[model samples]
Target: MLTPLVDPDGAPFWEYAAQGELRVQACAGPDCGELRFPPRPCCPHCRSFDSEWRRMSGRGRIWSYVVPHPPLLPAYAAQAPYNAVVVELLDAPRIRLVGNVVAAPDAPLNSVDPARLRIGAGVKVAFTLLDDITVPRWLLERT
Candidate 1:
């Protein structure tokens, strides 16, 4: 029961992730160089259509996090107290993405104990299949 964060746009980014690749949108225009996520057809900076997909290293630090403690939808009530984290990718410093981490695809959202989740912790990408989409999750990396 994997729900995808998808849209009419940004489909390609998910497609690549499904293949176990992390990619970002980059500007191909001269001078207005920049990279971004949540893909757009043109550069947000210079509005350039000359953009391409570039792979990322997929390592990041925890920017912020919250542990949800309540009446989660009835379906998820059993998995209450889960931590959702906003991770700032080292490859894309200014941008961040949110996800959960687990040892397996079917692992509960609350699988990563709060005691183990912290701001500034080093994390690496992990993938879990929610139906057909392979969503990116995260895991604390050992020193």
Candidate 2:
């Protein structure tokens, strides 16, 4: 299984996730208020060092996805057909996150059917505690 390596810039992300909250790093520049993922120390838009963690609505759409045939990671061999999805946040379409879609907040990677996923399908964020780190996952929204 994969694990997240928390760094100074990304520590807040994990802290929020542990509390079951979804947040994104946003540039605090007055003229360049932009939201970014994979939290960074400097704003890519304005080169500003000031930033803040903003809570997200946890709503987004599937921008892309894939089901690895030959599991690349040996730990994932047992979950061969699991999916890795790219989701674009509803409020920030330019910001996308990669994760798996499960039936519930804490379900397994393969809990959701691969065939059921579709581009533009609505999804909501969910947190799962893995190895003491709470990671964000996705769940398909019921139409």
lDDT of 1 by residue, 1-143 (tens): 43876874588778888888877778889997698776777788988898878888999999998876673467667777777789999988987888885545568787766888778999888776787788888878863
Question: What digit string (tens of lDDT, one per residue) describes model 2 on residues 29-105?
Answer: 88887998889999988999999888899999999999998888889988768999999999888989999999997
Give each prediction's root-mean-square deviation over alpha carbons. 1.9, 1.1
Any residue pairs clashing in model 1, and if so which? none
lDDT of model 1, residue 35? 88
TM-score of each: 0.89, 0.96
Clashes of each: 0, 0
Quantify how close model 2 is to the true structure by its C-alpha RMSD in Å: 1.1
